[model samples]
Target: MPELGGPTSAPALLRPHDPAPPLLDAARLGVAAHRGLDVEALLTWTTDTADLLPLPGTGSTAALWSALASVAAADVGAARVLEPHLDALAVLAQAPTPVDLGAVGAGGSSTWGVFAAEGPGVRLEAHEVDGGWRLTGTKPWCSLAGTLSHALVTAWVSDDERRLFAVGLRADDVLPAAGPWVSRGLAQVVSAPVTFDDAPAVPVGPPGWYLRRPGFAWGGIGVAACWWGGAVGLARALWDALGAREADQLALAHLGAVDVALTAARACLVEAADQVDAGIDGKPSAVLARRVRTVVAGAVEEVQRRCAHALGPGPLTADEAFARRVADLGVYVRQHHAERDEAALGRDLLAAGVAPW
Candidate 1:
């Protein structure tokens, strides 16, 4: 709603017939990445949307719906950019010390990693200092790299005493190292290496709390929502192209397949949102988040296939926006972690076993 550079920079409550809130800001973030504006503007854009978070607090379906809309307008890059900020907000909402949610609600991003076991692995170490705590270590896959003013970092205390810490990145000691992400899709959302050189920090939760928290699964499902949005965005190409040109029987078949898969995907999201909200009564939430992600990812992949099959390489190569959208969504939905997540789902599935009709 502030003067972001792409999509609908003009603010409004909602699009004419759309159920989504004002989500056009994602377009601005997407174009900001494409335009090579750096992460500073991205930070600024994310910080401006204070009202976007659920008012009563975090964990609301409203937040998920809003994120879905945001992702739909731009792509998953925009969703990925804002997701961690929401993750931190959710963390703070349930934190021991009440952070000024209004103040910290502004822009920033951080990512927990796919790091290796011991060795020179990316780990943050915490020390009990006079003032508070200080962190020193390398954190890999630090998205938004040097641009964000703050980040919720994961660090180790002693042994496997891993904890999440809120650290100020604007401080002099912390160093965000430039590293190559080397992916065509999310190249704009940089995931460089960062080092905290005795930077002052505060513990977000007790040891191992980051993983134990319900917000972890909640945030994961939110990413699924982005993938769901991306599926919608990518499928739009099919909708428009198919409508404009006369479709043969095969083309109609492809369109029909896309519709069915997307219907299932959308239903998954709506059902998942209800599940997430229902789980707020201290129950474990959304065993189906990974399942939902897999469903949406499959739907997105199917849509990509059907769109390409129906329309061929002409529109893909010819329409820059369409091509870019397809590529971007392809890379972004991979946050699903493929079968690794599927394995987790399998374990849960086995634990729950089969249901009898």
Candidate 2:
């Protein structure tokens, strides 16, 4: 990892057993058989790895976000590792508590165990119960379900309203549906639907919390890092192809342009993180989040196109790692904020005389 200058100049910690590999490689395998047992281990491993260090007196916002991106690229299988660590992250970002710098870093496996990837393929509804909340419904596309300790799921509070709640999953909270995930890419991701027949859950925050605050924007930005990492993987693959003389001049030019796009996208991401750390409120964060997503999405698309063109039909063969990356990139890029919504935000920023710093 590159040394980033700040008040907190300590080296980022990684686990002793942490093998520094690409994000996809780390996330390749699905969750361990005993997710509960392994979640803490992964977290410990991440902290030991020294990747997630606190930024001195302020928040670990930038470090955590960067760690998420690194983990996403390292292992799409384990990409959701940070979900369980959200509570700790929120605490670290919001409070002035002295962060255990020796604790889990972003790429450590502990953070990945929070999300479970099974569901009933329907949106769930949450009801305020006597003690807490009862979640009854179905949720599709719960990635990493089999191994996650809990899932930070978004569910409607009740019918006919837009209220959303972030619920944590437990053993009895969710059950997997039949059939496996048949997606073209990220097949090992364990993304499936889950059913909650009056499952009990604890709400992370108040109603409408998912949509409000910097968490939502930050979540989007965090996911965007995964896409950006995928782009990096694709670009590297393209570079390898060029080295092998498999790419033509046009393909090479396109790859160069992709490099430019990735650089620009990364700059925007860091800038957004800085702004977020500085406590620049409201629309600025939203706009920066949108920009990071848009730039990354575009970069991934360009790399996919260039890689496909350069590598020819052989690269698409299922056995090839590059082919798998393309599929993963496609799935990851779809998580970006909508283009129209981002554009409208940009327009609002411009109308408000927001100047780039």
lDDT for model 2, please: 0.55
Candidate 1 C-alpha lDDT tens digits along 1-357: 111223333321122343444434555545534543345555455555534556212335644554544444454566567666666666667676654423333333433222212325567688879857788888877777576667777778888678777777766788887667787776777777887798887677788877767666666766766676666665666777777878889988987887888778767766666666666422235366677788878888898888888888897778876777777788777767788878887777677667412
The parts of candidate 1 lying over 4 Å away from their true place are: 1-38, 55-63, 100-120, 280-286, 352-357
Give the best candidate by lDDT: 1
RMSD of 1: 5.6
The lDDT of each candidate is 0.63, 0.55
| Residue range with the least summed lDDT across 10 consecutive positions in model 1 | 1-10
Segments of candidate 2 deviating more than 4 angstroms:
1-60, 80-123, 158-170, 246-248, 337-357
* TM accuracy, model 2: 0.70
106-224 in candidate 2: lDDT tens per residue?
Answer: 22233332232234446778787786667787877666566554445667765644333334444465686644777776565556677787776655545554456555566667677
lDDT for model 1: 0.63
